[model samples]
Target: MSTPPPRRASAAVASPTAPLIGLGAGAPVLAFDVGGTDIKGALFGEDGHIRCLARIPTPVAGDRTGQAVIAEIVNLAGRFAEVQPSVNPRALGLVVPGHIDTRSGTAVFAENMGWKDVAFRERVSALTGLPVHFGHDVRAAGGAEFRLGAATGLRDVVVVVIGTGIAGALFVDGRPYDGDGLAGEIGHAKVASGPTCACGGTGCLEAVASAAAIARRYSALTGAQVAGAKEVLDRSQAGDPDAKLVWKDAVDALALSFSHVVALLAPEAIVVGGGLAEAGPALLSPLTARLDEYLTFQRRPRILAARLGENAGLLGAAIGARELMVAGGTR
Candidate 1:
């Protein structure tokens, strides 16, 4: 495995004006945010603005070997370059879900994707002819939240994304903590003594509280097939007892999981993002109230909604790519 270059300290913590110093306004960087269902790509211009944004379905259908995923990303990069011929990307950043070892640039494991020990940085760089920085998708989102989004200016924070699954990005002392690719698995934490999870664990927070879980649980109870968690939330608002019960279960599980986070990390804030977060006060208000019930004397962290929405991971990838350029000893 090729080791990544040491990044400059200021590169990670620099203000918004810092990236525009060199090459007239800094060099363009390519960023990709890979999710279970879609891959979002963007090219960050010299002025720190995203351009040529695109999203495509992840290539995981027949590419069990993970080569197709790489090929799809390479193709996306080629198209991005073709679309923006004037801007030659100096570096690339890729963020993917699963147990990612960013220090070694490996996608260690993604259960849903079924890829293990994929050398992401090396392969992507080999195919694209650029320096690459690989990162965990949720952690990258957390980095973006800390640097430019909801958790900015906070020293201790936890950014949790609750979508198909629940994952957390821990920022301790104002830096994202990976814990060697295994730190923030709050989703798998057992929050109840019921319902088995896809991970073969009982009572996992993700199984009970994730967006998919809410919809699944509602359907199991009422035998009503709905689209997703949003439909369940709407049903709850429409006075459906089953939907309300399912939603309450998810909120309770989330509150229970967050209570443990508060007692342990004592963060100043916890920024909640992902699809479930779109419910806004419907989720946050009840979550805060329940979390208060679980904590006795623990420091209460302000629960805030993620401000970046769907673009958080993409922006974080750009940040990582810019740091890679700085780390490669370039201005």
Candidate 2:
């Protein structure tokens, strides 16, 4: 799993203005998660809960592209302020995926969104007149895992996401390690040995094991289009030959990638999330069996489902924003 290391340490004490702290006691942060298809915005209250959450389809093309995303977030900020006009939010917390340089607040690149080197933090901060705390979506999720979720209390764990694409967040010593700005890129790691990837590589894990890859490979083999990885899972359960082969291939490739991670990081647990992880036993039981069959010397880590469901990224974004606000002396 390619996981982003944490950019900072978890808070020593939760503050009144901290993102997930006060819940029913105080105001909430305006949180936004930018994605390829939609932008999800919500008010994450101090009590560690979400309110007024909504989604808007992302606009495509020209200057409206990036600004459109920012605009939705700013509008959400306005709504948050209007609802609790007495105490306004002083900052925004945002989570985005793909090659983000969190330190620079720049999206270095996002192949799915066709974005590059966009100073997203500055844009949002300028538009809202509030400081922005930005985080890589997967990395932020890892932070949440380390501080509060499945990977909590574990010294070393890998959080692997099998979604439209595959990626991961790593936690070591209860903190994320970025390796500069290029640490986690597990999805792009070579795994298939021959298939070409959209990132211009051959045999990338994303090419072989991601949700898109499962559907694409099934289509290529059977000349029939499947809805997504879930449909492929259904067909596999029904004993369809092509579906079985496709699903098996995905598991095998993912196991190969995880093996590499195990060899390198020695994480105590591997937490799996995303659309494919919803498969539960269909993915996990066999994956564990196969990995055990493949390795000899390495200590096998527990392969478990993600506890946070689809909201992990959003929750993580909230945490990242809170940490930033605290660090900046806003709380």
Candidate 3:
């Protein structure tokens, strides 16, 4: 093992104006959020501010995808070091999509990225010569929301990211409930029948409720080849019949899935985010109404939109890095 850098206590303290408390408030840190197409990297300084940030295209290396990503991370780290030579990072936080096993520090599977059982934490630590914290991207974003976004102070909440695919971060009793890193696969939960999903499942929640699903279904129904879900939403508001039908189905599927979650977990809040969440009230109002239809005896959760925007996952990764030095994170 390589020699570890000199340790320093974390100095991050959550402030009212900012969602993050003490980020790289000590020995500095590197954080990365790896998406299927892009990788976002940031460096945090002793004062907990982002000292450097960059986004790079994710390499398409087939079976070598994992190695390629690790190389990119190393390159980003070196770039940050060049930009801030005075800082010596003590830890690195990394997050990626799909099923994750944080306990094992592995990417269990990511269909889009074409990788499985990739031990990211061990590899990154070995290459970077620093302690590495690994996590799921959606869950990391949810952590940011829980500590610094919409669900702050909520003990029981579900932070659902509704972009290309639907996934969730489960918080129970004010602590993240990872279920061994697979508990938040709410997207795969069966909702309807017919129409196969990318995971080879039929009637999965993500197949019907996700932003990608909305656009795909609308394009199929109307044969109009819309640009994205936002366009479909706009058409629906403009009284387009096909767009309305697709949008309603998407909302209904979401409500059905959310109602099941409410019945099982009874979360105090359901914080929605990601590309679809940009619809704001247009999405939440109808979903809430449909959810109410299914919840006759269960407690209705307050459905709120995420406030942290696109940077939540990166911020959460930074939090994971800072947690290595801080006694209690989000303080």
Number of clashes found in candidate 3: 3
Tell me the lDDT of model 1 at 252.
94
TM-scores for candidates 1 onward, in order:
0.90, 0.88, 0.90
What is candidate 2's lDDT per residue for 257-290, written digit by digit as tens?
8888898888899999888899999999889988
* lDDT tens digits, residue span 175-218, model 1: 77888888889999899997999999999999999999999999
RMSD of model 3, in Å? 7.0
In model 1, which regions exceed 4 Å deviation?
1-25, 63-65, 329-331
Q: What lDDT does each candidate get?
A: 0.84, 0.76, 0.86
Query: Which regions in candidate 3 have their CA more than 4 angstroms from the true location?
Result: 1-27, 327-331
In model 2, what lDDT does residue 290 have? 83
Query: On a 0 to 100 scale, what is the lDDT of residue 53 in model 1?
Result: 72
Cα RMSD to the true fold for all candidates: 7.7, 7.7, 7.0
TM-score of 1: 0.90
Rank by lDDT (best first): 3, 1, 2
